[model samples]
Target: MHPKLVEFLAGCRDEAPLQLGVLPFGMICGIASLAAGMPAWLAQLASAIVFSGAAQLVIVQMLAVGSGAAPIGLTAGLLGVRHVLYSVSLADYVRHLPRRWRLLLAYLLTDEAYAIAILRYQAQTAAVHQSVPGTPPGNTAPGATGDAEGSPVRDLRHWYFFGCGLTLWLTWQVSTAIGIVFGATIPADWDIDFAVPLTFIALLTLLIRERANQAAAAVAALGALLLAALPYNLGLVGAIILGLMAGALSTRLARRTRLAREASQ
Candidate 1:
């Protein structure tokens, strides 16, 4: 077996649950799109090509509500803004590669893929930094050079990321096809509505592990509820923007406060 395959398998074992969780949601998006009267092929294509769960759900929901294509396009655009950030972050690691390779990397840069890649990248980076002189013990700066023996390990991380992306892509395609085929057979009263809220609540709870993130989440929730009446689902857009701004501002403030305390000491 290739060294990277072993590392990829190890990393994937730890991510099994999250991988399963994402599949059902992606399938649900497919079912929802079909239920919303989307063409079967369209739903399947969206799941195959777009591969973003939240954005796909939002698009299908809008379509179900008789919303215009423009709004759906806009929603997808707004949700996809996160990809730009991911690309920039990943650039530091793969920037030296050929432009053709970069294009392939960009296509595979979904949320799950990015998470796995970034974690492996950070781990390799920290290992490298630890080997360097004058660097902190735990600093994980990208581009930090690992020892000669560690080069194989670092090289292996890329294959790990590729495997993760490929696995997710296959799962998404299979689950989506199933959803499109059997969506109408599922009953509406199956009590699946709770899943969405529960998933988000779980996500929110995780994000609230820090005081600043907690405060920002609270503020954003309020802003979203207050603006919930906006038409064309612009309220959703407003809520996201407000929430992001609140989180950013609060996090900056918290950092400043911490710095001030250190200075005072």
Candidate 2:
């Protein structure tokens, strides 16, 4: 096998465990999509096209409730705002790739894929930085360009990202197909919709390692609750915007504090 293929397979292996969590969410999304009176084909198509569990769930819920197109579009768009951050974080790692490759990877990018890819990128970056004699610890900058040149690991990072994304894409499509086919058989009392929020909660738990993230999340939750009565579910959009602002502010404050401490020292 080519070295890239080997690295890709390794990436797939690394991502396999996370797919267990993703599978049920994809299935639940399909179930909800169909339950909302959407055709089975469209449900599966949305999985293939949108490829976003949270956004898909929002689309289904809005459709089920007979929401207007503007609200549904706004809700889904708001739910997907996080992907912009993911793309920004991933840009440095993938910037060397061709435009077509970058576009395809962008399409394949998801919460699970981004999480795994970032960890791999950071690990490889740290390894490279440590192997060099002059590099200090904790100095692995996001846009470190030297990591990619003549570095097999850097070359493989894209393949690894592709492998993780492909595995997730396949898992989502297959699980969604099964759900679409068997949706009618599911018990109405089961309330499989709970899986959507649970999946997000699990993702959030993994992501909120920093104090700024926690603060932003708390503020966002409060904002959402306070604005819950807004018409056409616009509160969802408001909460998302408020969350971004809060997170950005918290991060800025933390950075400034760290800089001040460094100056004092």
Q: Please, what is the whole-model Cα lDDT of each candidate in the order they appear?
A: 0.69, 0.79
Model 1 ranges off by over 4 Å: 89-91, 113-156, 197-212, 231-233, 261-265
- lDDT per residue (tens digit) for residues 30-109 in model 1: 78887888889888888877878778888887888888888789888887876886787677677655788677667767
lDDT tens digits, residue span 1-265, model 2: 7767876897799889777677778878888888899888888889999998878887888888888989788778877887898998787777778999999999999988887778767666678676775554233333232344665323546777889999999999998997888867878797765665665676677777788878878888888899999855567668877887999999999999999999999
TM-score of every candidate: 0.75, 0.81
User: How many steric overlaps are in each model, in order?
Assistant: 0, 0
- Which number leads on TM-score? 2
In the predicted model 2, the residue pairs found to clash are: none
